[model samples]
Target: MPKHVWITRGLAAIAVGGLLAATACKPGDGTSGAGGELDGVTLTVAAKWTGTEQKNFEEVLDGFEKDTGATVNYEATGEDTGAYLGPKIEAGEPPDIAALPQPGLVREYAEQGALKPLQGEAATALESNYTGYWRDLGSVDGEAYGVLLKAAHKSIIWYRPSAFDAAGVTPPETWDELVDTTSRTLSNAGITPFAMCGASGWTLTDWFENAYLSHAGPENYDKLADHEIPWTDDTVVQTLTTLSEVWGEDDMMKGGQKGAVQTAFPTCVSEVYGQEEAAMVFEGDFVGSSAAEAGATVGEDAVAFPFPAVGDKAPVVVGGDIAVAMTERKGVQELMAYLASPQAQSTWAGLGGYLSANSGVQPDAYADEFTQDLSATIVEAGENVRYDLSDQVPSRFGATEGRGMWSILQDLLRGSTDPEGAAKALEKAASEA
Candidate 1:
């Protein structure tokens, strides 16, 4: 991510909470302070989770610490965790385990043999709790290396139901219908149909991913993600061209394209719920909490629907934190198994703003009915679910600012790059990366 962008998204998340403070995490099993299974073992774990996320994660880790009488230390990696761990790995010192949202990084470290294969109880826990797509996501070749600890459903669009009612519009089920709703809401309701978060390039990446996944279908989406196909493929251009229906229109977005390119992501969400500056915003399920913070009453004041399919199947693009064991120490293996369990995941899911890919976790683990339904939609998708494509590709290609897909698509929103031009630029960056 760009420095400014990370300062905005990554830093902001970690601001309100400490590391759950490493020292505060260890001591007793309550049963046998010095005699539990992992007694005398000390483990180091790292991830970008902080504030409420950090506190919630701590509840899970605290469970493990209490059950096994092990000493566990937490490290907050802030942004660019790969950068933070690279030198440590080079020095032959790596955390016992690390939680990463990027599957690409898991693949990179596992291929380099820096991460240990998760097997035995850990593998069983993973297999029982998750589906094939998640299994594939956390594996390198045929070996399991990580467990998806939490997930965010990114294939959702947020809007005010009253706004749609005022415009006489319904939740769209197909791409053409979605574009028409955009037009209807603007023409009849006189409100901007979309709150485009162009400044935070990753949001634009999500926009392209949902469209691409639906238009190209999962097989091609996977092929493109793995670089088995070129970005200049016809599907890439077609998806971009399809998106142009909205982007190409001057009045389709609040604040117009130029203004959107300067609007931060939080502002984009707030514009709809807080200021009523726009009628809709599309992104991850996290938008729900952000909207609630802006004083929207969730299912009543704010509503979301799956991003409409361009072809047949609606896309379910997820971004999740994968817990990768950097060492196969006994304590690390035990912790890995525990992290994959329903007992561990449910502890966090109940905290709100958190979702789990673990099927063993019941919907009621979520805080409310709306969240429960959304969580069910994601879990029920099973092997059909797709990991966020940008999250799976190399970061320089997936995440860089003013370069790669981020810049290409940002230019698309600005009307500075046509579909073909965007395709060419994407191919160039993917090849270089």
Candidate 2:
């Protein structure tokens, strides 16, 4: 979902050219001075970021270049990064680095020797900046292979302040209270309370993930993600039924379930901020940008709050891109180290539309009050943060369209299956995966 932005290519990047420079030094070595350690290095880094996100990342790259004198080429792989990276890697010509989209892919590539093991300074940087929760997401078989360069806190609900004021209802802190608020907003203000992104399968998964994490607790969430328990387990059935409490309500979704199934992801954000506005849309923090596109000013015209507590604690479902080294080339380890440090992530953190897993990054480094609070929320959560379950699971069971979590949840939204039926279908898909 972090990559699901309105991306567009802007200025051209340095082409994959020039010679591979020799390793002059590691991070903090004297060679980073003028005529720098990586003076002649040309490192190629590939990812799915473009548009403003791309522009912000280039600023991070510019800093790396200035510090190390490395000439880095930027490669945008669009949505289908594997299609672009797969052939290049198979031909024994992988880029120096790539920002893998999923934790599962990081493990697969690490197991297959497609990814190089990050050692020494890079590993140390990762451990120092991030908690075990973050470090483990980038490691395989007890070895670190990736660094989470960008992060997203997904358990956020964006709403119109005017809608809440009109209804005289404050944001709720508990699930039952949220359910009550939704009804009150509709009854008191004649507002449609929720904008559903049923058409974007991943958003539905996020909904389920938040419920599962809070209701079943983090340990069970981890087990379910690893398939240690079947999808048909009671916890999953209970979570699905909980989701239906809202989905089953005729007036809960802005256009009802059918229309929700027809709505794309961004439309869900805009529908809450545009004329004839709905009261709310529940998604990741990325919705802030989509709200802006709808002519809504973030933290003013629109505001976000933590997803209400479903059980004893609030759930934080994190989504992010992990930087992985594909080869042990000169300047690669140094770049990896920099990315794992607060210095690199903070560069983009102030530029907006980004959060860093690096705890060393101070909350004040963010652009505004909303971002500062959001960044602080993530850092304070420490090892309590969990990565996206769908991203951690096998793609066949997690991401495939017309099957897996996407199809099952979409079917659930359409009232095509009951909670138990949805659980069974998901179990069948996971077994196949």
Candidate 3:
């Protein structure tokens, strides 16, 4: 997962009356010149971003500071933001704003009364920039509290075009076709059919989610995500059985199941692109960057297709960050509103590793044609998009190490458990979580 960060300096304090007058100004109501209404206000923001992502976000913060004259203090605390913020929140000194990646955590904070509802420019900017599905993701009980900042499309299958061409195979269009293609690649080309990153359980969960979403349809996908339907439901069993068609095969995966369980995500990409040991890998658009880092020519040596349809329609699963305000200060709201704007999103998108759900941003904002096409595919999905199911559930059942979906699915791939048994284990975990 990627992180996002922004920082600025604080302004001199203004009188209460002056603050009230400043709050009345809407976004774009005044020229972005010197001596803006928020000239003297300062805010603190925390996120799990560092390195280039932090640098890219700093460009957006610079724009905000120039536009509003407010300063912000930024912190890159890595992925354990809950650990970093928990004590401060308990001590009554939380940051003015925080960029949270998990919608489940956003809902947790909002339900616990630790998050402030978006108002004024922030509220208006989100309404104008994002779609209803995005807006709903940031809301709790019909009240908006967070704004989606960055996004990743998780419904792509990446492969080396040369490998496919050598094997006389084209991108499959349906589940049966995908199976046939895999079999043909193995029998005809003498190469592994799939690069299954079983070591990273989250990747395994994505496989199941993509299959289940198409198998059960959007409504049931939501129900399963919310635990409205038991894991033992027939849809789950069918999904697992469908997945086993490939996972359970003797030589369908690289190094068989054992090799997949030992291979990490980066190595999985390397196997397909660097070593030419595998024919295909299923992952999000972010894999393009990873492939480049591993010395593969993305979009040339490597190309991607939408995950093949298992039912009537293909499904799109997304993962991203949401910016939430912890205080209602004028400067905080102004910063949140700016972050949701096309200008700020475009600045980040130009950095080559960022994507935004904000529909207002133009296609030319991206760094390459492939990214632009990928973003267009996501935008076209619109209301049909679904979030990563494991990320939507409780941390104990979804994110915990050694006990969550990661370990359970690894067991299934290792042939220690069957689909029915795995489904029962998932139900028990969800119930306990």
Tens digits of lDDT, candidate 2, 1-433: 1211111111011101110111223453222333577898899999999999999999988888998788889999898677788898889999999999899989988887899988777877776677678888889989899988888889888888777777877777778888876555665668888888899999999999999999999999999998999999999999999999888775787788888888889988888987635888999889999899889888787787788788888888889899999998988888888777767777788889998767677655678767766666666565456899999998878877777899999999989999999999999999998
Q: Candidate 1 lDDT, tens digit per residue, 1-433?
A: 2111101113223421321111121221011122477888899999988788888888878888887888889898887888888998999988999998799998899889899987767777777667788888899888999998989989888887667667777777788888876555565568778888899999999989999988888889989998999999999999999999988887888878888777878889999998887788989888977898899987777878778888887888999899999986768877888888777777788877788877667656677766766666666675457889998888889988877888888888888889999999999999999
**Of 1 and 3, the candidate ranking higher by lDDT:** 1
- 1-433 per-residue lDDT for model 3 (tens digits): 1011000011112112222232223454222323567788888888888887788887778887887778878888678787887888888889998988788989889888999998877788788777788899999999999888989889888887777667777777788888977456654688778888888888988998999988889899999989999999999999998988888875888888788787888779888888888878889988987888878877677778778889887888888888999877767877878887777887888987887777666667787666766666555565568888888999888876688787888888888899999999999999999
**TM-score leader:** 2
Per-model C-alpha lDDT, please?
0.80, 0.81, 0.79
TM-score for candidate 2: 0.91
Q: How well does candidate 2 score on lDDT at residue 280? A: 84
| Rank list by TM-score | 2, 3, 1
Model 1 residue 305 CA deviation in Å = 0.8
Winner by TM-score between candidate 2 and candidate 1: 2
Could you estimate the TM-score for every candidate?
0.90, 0.91, 0.91
Clashing residue pairs for model 2 = none
| CA RMSD of all predictions | 8.5, 8.1, 8.9
